[model samples]
Target: AQRVTQPEKLLSVFKGAPVELKCNYSYSGSPELFWYVQYSRQRLQLLLRHISRESIKGFTADLNKGETSFHLKKPFAQEEDSAMYYCAPPFYGGATNKLIFGTGTLLAVQP
Candidate 1:
């Protein structure tokens, strides 16, 4: 089945360090990628989506179809950025659209 992969389970970095959250996907059609984030005790919410080509909270992800990847990146890390980050693609199942999310990578920003 088509899926998204987040290779790292935990990514720890000191404040001001550059951060990258890896995400790779496999799909047959033109895919829509999303980065979802869950802060501590908070619900998962959309961080960014590929089609809009937008950046959220100083983070950006570019779709590279040739590489089948949409890796999330930031120029620097901050304590507030600590959270669980998921890579996802919309799954068209029957009449409904569902999201298939990666196992998620926890970003820990150490001060």
Candidate 2:
């Protein structure tokens, strides 16, 4: 079974401060990790993927295979950056492009 874990349910940070959201996973096979974000009243969108090595909205996440982790980080936080973040891994069954998400972390950036 593949599992993604986001230990923090809520995180608050002041504007301009750096932020890091912790994530861990347990999977026997090679994992495909992704970060998904949902803004207020908006649909969830892909933030980044381990395979892409791309950064979005000043946020970046690196998949650490050794640690079984993919922690998201940003050097500076903005009020606009506040959102619900989820760590997701592909479903084990290999059915379509579906993803199983971890309990998300709600990020609140105080102005």
Candidate 3:
């Protein structure tokens, strides 16, 4: 079975502080990993991808194959960064582009 797990439902932190959102997964085959974030009341957008090896919005994620984990990290948290973050894994082959999402972690960046 393919599944994604976000350990923390909420992560509260101060502005300029570091933030880390934990994510774990279970899949028999190779799967793509992505971090989708929603800032404040904004719609969910792609933050980063493990395959790209690039950072977006000051956030980066590393996919640990052995650990079956892909954790999102940012050195400095901005008040504007306060949002709901969801870690997801897309189904490789299907009729539609459907992505399985985690419960999500609400990041509160207090100023």
Best by lDDT: 1
Tell me the TM-score of each prediction against the true structure: 0.97, 0.94, 0.93
Give a tens-digit lDDT track for model 3, residues 50-102: 99999888899998889999999999999988899999988866676578999
Clashes in model 2: which pairs?
none
Instruction: Tell me how far the alpha carbon of residue 111 in candidate 2 is from the true structure, in angstroms, after superposition.
Output: 1.0
Runs off by more than 4 Å, candidate 1: none
Model 2 CA lDDT for position 110 = 98
| Superposition TM-score, candidate 2 onto the true structure | 0.94
User: What's model 1's lDDT at 66?
Assistant: 98
lDDT for residue 12 in candidate 1, whole number 0-100:
98
Error of 3 at 30 (Å): 2.1
Give the Å error, residue 58, model 2.
0.9
> Global CA lDDT of candidate 1, please?
0.96
Q: What digit string (tens of lDDT, one per residue) describes model 1 on residues 1-111?
A: 798999999999999999999999989989999999999999999999999988899999999999999999999999999999999899888998799999999999999
The clash count of every prediction, one per candidate, is 0, 0, 0
RMSD to native for every prediction?
0.8, 1.2, 1.2
